[model samples]
Target: MTNPLGIVGAGIGGLTLACALEQQNIPFTLYEQAESFEALGYGIQVSPNVVRVLAALGLTEKLEAIAHRCYGFELRSFTSDQTLIKWQLPKNQLYYQCRRADLHQLLFDGLRDKSKLNFATRLTGYSQTTDKVALKFEHAPKVEVAGLVGADGVGSPTRRQLMLDSQQTKPSYAGYAAFRAILPWRSPYEELAGRATVWLGKNHHVVAYPNGNLNHGEQWLNLVLVVKESQWQEEGWTIEVDKSQVAAEFQNQSRLLNQILKDMIASPEPCYKWGLFTRPALPFWSQNKVTLLGDAAHPMVPFQAQGAAMSIEDAYVLAQCLQRHQTTEGAFQQYENLRYQRATRMQITSRKNADIFHASGLKAIARDFVFKIVDAIAPNLMNLKSAWIYDYDVTKL
Candidate 1:
């Protein structure tokens, strides 16, 4: 009998890959360090590109039930109460804004081989041979895998080991911090309740959209503030912070923006923040039988909101290659060849967006001028600009 494939994380990318493998009757085991799943993370956006993959994996009905479909966004200036760009998202393609924990549960429950999943199994290290890779967990005995996949996310031990052994660049801090808040979407903020909005400022930017809890019958709003702060260096990590402190960070913004930021956590619970980080797209994501996926391979800043979307795409494309190619070696190569360019482009463009979103002085003027021209000449240019990303259908690939 063949050894089962090893998946070293239960994140969005990891579980998605596992489900796809199970759908095809491919043997695989998932290792998760967390004792149990929790809705701990912040908001997550699912673009049309990833929705197509999820639908292909038989998650269409489930997503339709819980995912909040967002049609467009109104980009506003932080200093002035003026519209910068009114982008009407493409109609044919669907986009969903959701709680990360909610989406994680949906993916987790959809997996077929729960019997093969191991929780609280921290991946300590691994060793690879000619035909198999051996994984060492903190508690469990060493397990051999026919092929190894590292979906462990940024600061991945698997990636660190691979780069250390092969002499490659490690993941580095992206010089920004992300403050996130989730709270009830109630009365008084009617204008901000149901739509996605972006507030662009110098050296910082903010995004807010509607998200809800289907189980609890609650309406909520999700806010994320990305700012340049190099003084505190916390690499690839998130920590609990005071809600009042979070409000103060954005206190100088417009009245509406300030009110929304303050109300994001009106409850007693605290808010949280994390340092954003990334690594240059590796020249090769796969070496021998071991490979990297998702944030483990290409962690990007959140400017384009495609971090999870790209990871979902990676899983779908890799699964297709694995089923199509007879050998794991050829499948890995084909997967990288097909996916590397797209992932690299996403990483680079995400960085570019950080600069574009936080432009100041002459740069800001030039940006707004271009936006005005585009908004006037081509109102749907934003949709057309992202057609390559949204139109991607991995099932068709």
Candidate 2:
């Protein structure tokens, strides 16, 4: 307990782990490569499962104050221009769509001592022993700790280093990329602000929802346009786009979809883009006192919308086991045992959704027919899938 636990990456998973450890009075240090945290990215949905963890950390009040509570989730058809299906969100205890930075800040400020965070100190290398481990960074001297965690994200250096002892690994691209726009929420768009809508098409889908935290006082609809691609050579989370180029891609879809895309294009903001990536479930999640968390363990395509939620779940469960088990190995083993099956299932489900969402020809026809019948017979059938995800409370793990 004397040596502070070393955590690499200050992302949602890393931040959540740090906060959970602090709540349990465990000393820890969080390292981030970024010089300073900036507000980037678009809307993120904090579903019921994740909110339970935040509520445990005493962040419910702050979170509810900033995020928009989701009223319902509707999936619409782009070809037919009709509502394919809908699920009414539970009363007041529904899902929330918060700006990514807003949630990060909530966890960031929850730390008791700001000095515990070391920014601009990237992980360069690491070595471990039975007693403790040493962490090397790009900008500073090495530090040793009882345990080391890789919450750095998909390209986690900690994961790569651990992989040296086992199977070689790398993040694989999904041959598709997403373009995002924060359209100004005003006048005509005002009425659609709070609803979470998904427009399903032949080879793509669009997810749109309003977030009130774009500019100082302005509101904006966060639209994510996901389409198939041949190749992407981008290096970062966002990129510049020729408005006409984006428009041309979606011109074949519905008129409503086109109008929304056009308005988003007219906005002054440059479109943010990132390639969707996927990876096989790791052979394992732990090696000695070093282990993985979040995307580092199981990176998946974003079809399930559980990327962040699963990470939040991992953070809580990891901290819980680490607090109880006497040895780091036992703690990590239990953590994986509790999570591996469920996490793998989620990856499979999310990946399968891509095929379903992007269906064409005979596949698309059968998919629509099945959905129509389900909507007629059991309207709430699709909503039940959420209980497996949203109903989980990691604090009780």
Candidate 3:
């Protein structure tokens, strides 16, 4: 029998890719560094672009049970406390808001061969021959497989080994970080039920939405507060910090902002902070029988909320490419060809949104004015502009 493909890192992207491959009867061995899967991460938006992918995997009904089906988006001015743009989706279009752990569990349950999972196996590096690739793990035996995939995330060792000299592999601080919390929902906030609200401020922005419960009985609300920082070199998502740090950053902002921060502080939950980082899109992501997917290939800032969506999209497409092409090299080439351009565009656009969302003074005024003009003249204009993002269906490609 042919050897199973080696998937490094069991993140959402890796697990999604594995589940896709399993559907096609493709064999794979999934390696995770952690000893066991724990409920990590605050919340994530499963945008319309990726909802189709989940449906294809026969996971839509399960997702619906545990996710809040968001109906639309609202962009508001932080200084003025005024709604700038409000747009809703058609009934057919589906957008979900849920805890990242819940989404991760959903994908994990979708996988058939749980026995293929490996734990406490930290990938150190890898080397590839003409036909097979060997994955090196810390204090563990090197395993050889027909192909290798790097879904190990931003600090991916697989990505490091694949492109040693490429400048794109290095990540630079994006001058900001996010303070995230998942607060239990006792009641609904204004426009936060079944909708995502973006509070745009000078050098900062806040996104809040209802996150469906994780069998904890009470519903939850997810909050991500992005603030500009002069110096913060660390990059991680699960670093716990005091809520006072978040309060100090936005103390001079709006009253609503203060209230939100107060509620976060009052809640028993802890706030986690992670520095935002970005890397240039790689001109190539695969070499020989080894390749990359998700943040391992292209890491982006969260300004556009497409970071996870892009990875999920990459997972399905890469699985398709591998199933179609007989040779691993051929499959890697086709996957890169189909994904590079679109993923690069997302990276660039996401960076641009950072500037747009954090506009100041006259630029902020102009930004609000443009959205107001579009809202009044053509309310549907926002929906029309985001069509390219939400309308993507990877199954059609």
Candidate 4:
């Protein structure tokens, strides 16, 4: 199709979509609110599901060089300091934990030269006639296109303009805060092999994993601490926080974990925090020539670690839908039909995992018991259970 497709947000979802559409010989333009395509933040888990999508885009070699392959996730009890579950990951499936910047670069670099990726071009408003959509930008010239994609994330301007109903569900605070930081590898922990680890405690949890290429000496370790809180001010993930404050929150944690936090807090850089938020399921993902993708369509808790994965899935499926259908609207409806249920299920599952991960009192003990039994009976159960998610091949769909 020669009709130009416009995408807002150059995030994982938007960039991936741009690349996929390009590969399919589709014409498109990508607008990013950021000033430049600079890498941001600490680390993210790219499960086999996401890896499969990246591989389809021919990014395997570049990504593999920078990502740490984790065999599985180990869950431990914070109070007892005992291993509760050691769920073996998928056998043939490889999971990578890489710096967010490195992943972003891989996607950004993959876009075709013809793909117009305009930075600092924020979406201000948009209007649609019977045949085309006209997009207005904050600092750039307006453009008319066959379709507009709202890959702009949870605070999507397209969503706001399209679904203006006062009753529409807004993203609410999830009553928890997460602090993520990257520390230089040092000594014992440095020598320790790359693996993902989760320490679960009452009302909080800590997840750590090796990030960056293993060949680049010892890789940097990424740490994320989620704690229940009464108030959260920031709504976006990039909001800044005091490192000392974050350190204080985890001071009562295990000594070993506390040491890690101290090192993170002592870093010269400011720590960031954001209140996780999600919208109630929208009845549909599209209207006219406009549609949502990634966090724009479905935002989920990070407990499942599938936020980026879902967006990757959306990117591939959306391109497929457009390729298979005659009109933009038809393609959108088909995309929603194929994606809504899966995204909603993932959102619910992530929420459920949050409850389990943050269990307190007797509930925490029960959770530990279940983990032990499951680990003993089926060492690979965790990996097996997520097979339906991780093993999915979107290209074949």
Candidate 5:
């Protein structure tokens, strides 16, 4: 009997890759470090590019049933209360605004009958021979996989064992921190039920959008606040934070905005906070039979909301490369080549957005002015600027 493929981390990237492999009738096992599937109290934007991949994977109907289709994104200046830019999202393609949990559940349900998923199994180490790879789990029996795909995320242990110096470009605090929470859709903000809004300031930004459906009683809004900060030692996504401190971070903003932050803080649920981190592009994404995917390969800031989208793209393309190539090593090389430039470009662009959104003095004025003019004359063109990103169809390749 042929050995099944082994994947670490049951994230969107991992699960999506697993589904793709399953579609091709390739056997695989997914190991998640977590004890069980649970909501992580965070929200992520599913851009059209990612939506297309999901559609190809036969998940569009399920996703569309639960997600709110965000029409356009608007950037508003906090000081002047004026709209800086209003770019319409791509048409025909659907962009979902659902919680990470809802999306995860969708993928999990899709794989419910696969009989190959293993949870609470943490990967401790791995060894790769010329033809196969063996993985060691902390509390589970060792399993040998035909190939190891490390979708284990930014702090990937598999990547640590395989790479020469995986810790060299360690995730550093990008001089900023983010606070995210989900609120039940109430009135007043209900006007924002369908659209995504970005309130931009000198060194801070607030983004809010609805998720789930109003009729299904699953309607909720996801809000994220990014603020410039001096220090951040914690690196994981599940870091705990003080509510008042989060509210204080945006004390200088408008009262209405502060009220939103205050409501989020007062909620019974715990708020997760973390210093946004990014790693320098690795020279290569693979070594022999082991390769990296998602945050393990390219961790980027959330400036462009492409973090998860890129990972979804990686899973699709990596699967494609593997299907096309004869050997694991060849597929890894091609996957790196096809994905490296685009991911790196996005990483650089997301960083630039951080700087541009936080600029002060003359730079800030120029930035705002450009956004206004672009919104007025060429709104569609402004939206199409991201066509290179949104229009990417991995299946064709």
Candidate 6:
């Protein structure tokens, strides 16, 4: 009998890839290090591009049940809280704001065969031969795989071993930190429901949107505060922090900002802060029978809000390539070729947005002025600008 394909890391990318592979009737096993899936308490944007892929996987109704469909996006000023640009999102294509854990759960439950999922299985290393790859584990016996996919996220062991030359390089800090929290949806912020909002400030910005718990029938708001920070150098998204650490950074700010921050702090939910970091692009993502996917291949700053979306797209494309090609090397090569340019573009653009969103002094004034003019002349152009990204359909690829 033919050996099954093996996938490492059961993140959004890994789970989505498993679903896609199942649709193609490809045999595979998914390995996850965590003993069980934990609920992540952050909001994730699911743009139309990724919604296309999820819908293809028979998750449309399930997604609608858990996610809030965003009708538009508004950008406001930090000091005045005045709207700089407001545009309705594309009606034909659906955009959603949902809790990361809810979406993760939906994807996990979407799989046709739960038996293929192996939790508490940590991959230590892997060795590849011409015909198959052997995956090493810390506790269990090694498993031979016909083809190996490293969906392991940032600081991936697979990437480290694959790129012997680049092993010495570390992830460069993006000179910023992000604080994420969730609060109950209330009257003062009732206008924020069914829409996404951003308050752009000097060297900082805030994003807030409506998300809810479907199981409990409760309404909630998700908040993310990003600010310039060069002193602290910690990484990872789950680092608990006192709200004072965030409040201290925004002294003498507008009342609107203060109220939101206060709401975030008063919430019973835990608050998390993590430094933003980006890694240098890999020269190649594939080597022989093995290749990387999602943050494993390219970890980017979150300014563009496309980090998860790109992973979802990558999952579908990689699975299609694997099914289309006969040899594992050919499949890996084609997957990298198809995804490298698009993923790199997202990484670079996300980095540039950090500066754009945090523009201050004359740059900030000029940026707001341009937004006003564009908002007056042609608001649709603002939405059209992202057409390339939202209009993409990976299932068709």
Clashes of each: 0, 0, 0, 0, 0, 0
Most lDDT-accurate candidate: 3
Between candidates 4 and 5, the one scoring higher on lDDT is 4
Give the per-residue lDDT of model 3 (tens digit) for 1-397: 1788999888899999989999999989999999987656779999998999999999998888889889898898877778898888877799998989889999999988899889889998888888788888996799999999999998888888888856756877888888899787754365478789899989889998988843444478899999888778554555788898787777644566677788899999999888888898876899999898999899999988898898899999999998899998999899999989989999999999998999999999999999999888877777877888999899888
Clashing pairs in 2: none
**lDDT (Cα atoms) of all candidates against the true structure:** 0.82, 0.82, 0.86, 0.83, 0.81, 0.85
TM-score of each: 0.95, 0.95, 0.96, 0.95, 0.94, 0.95
lDDT at residue 37 of model 4 (Cα atoms): 82
The digit string of per-residue lDDT tens for model 6 on 1-397 reads 1788899999999999999999999999999898977655478989999999998889998888888888889998977788899999877979888888888888888888999989888999999888999999887789999988999988788888898747444466778888888888777887787788998999889898988543346667888889998856454545899987786776434666678788776778888888787887888989998899999888999988999899899999988998899988898899899889989998988988899899999999999999999999988797777877888787887
For residues 18-136, could you state the per-residue lDDT of candidate 5 as single tens digits? 88887767678999999877644357788888888888989988888878888888888867657788777766757778887888878877774456888889999998888889999
Worst 10-residue lDDT window for candidate 3 reads: 212-221
- Screening candidate 3 with a backbone cut-off below 3 angstroms (N, C-alpha, C), the clashing residue pairs are none
| Least well predicted 10-residue stretch by lDDT in candidate 6 | 211-220
Q: Candidate 6: where are CA atoms >4 Å away?
A: 165-169, 213-216, 235-237, 251-255
TM-score for candidate 5, please give it.
0.94
Which tens-of-lDDT digit does each residue in 1-397 have in candidate 4? 4468889999889989999998887778888988888866688999888888888989999888888888877888877658898865756987899898888888888986733988889999999987889999999898898899999988888887878743574566777888778888655465234578888988888888888887774478888889988787654566777888887776654666777877887766567777787767887879989999999889888998999889999999999898888788888889989999999999999988889999998899898998999988986877767887888888888
Stretches > 4 Å off in candidate 2: 165-168, 213-218, 252-255
The CA lDDT at 223 in model 6 is 88
Query: Residue 8's C-alpha lDDT in candidate 6?
Result: 93
Checking candidate 4 for backbone clashes, the offending pairs are none
lDDT of 6 at 174: 76
Off by over 4 Å in 1: 165-168, 213-216, 234-236
Model 2: per-residue lDDT, tens digit, 208-247?
8877542344466778888988787877756877866876
Q: Candidate 5, which segments miss by more than 4 Å at Cα?
A: 112-114, 234-236, 252-256
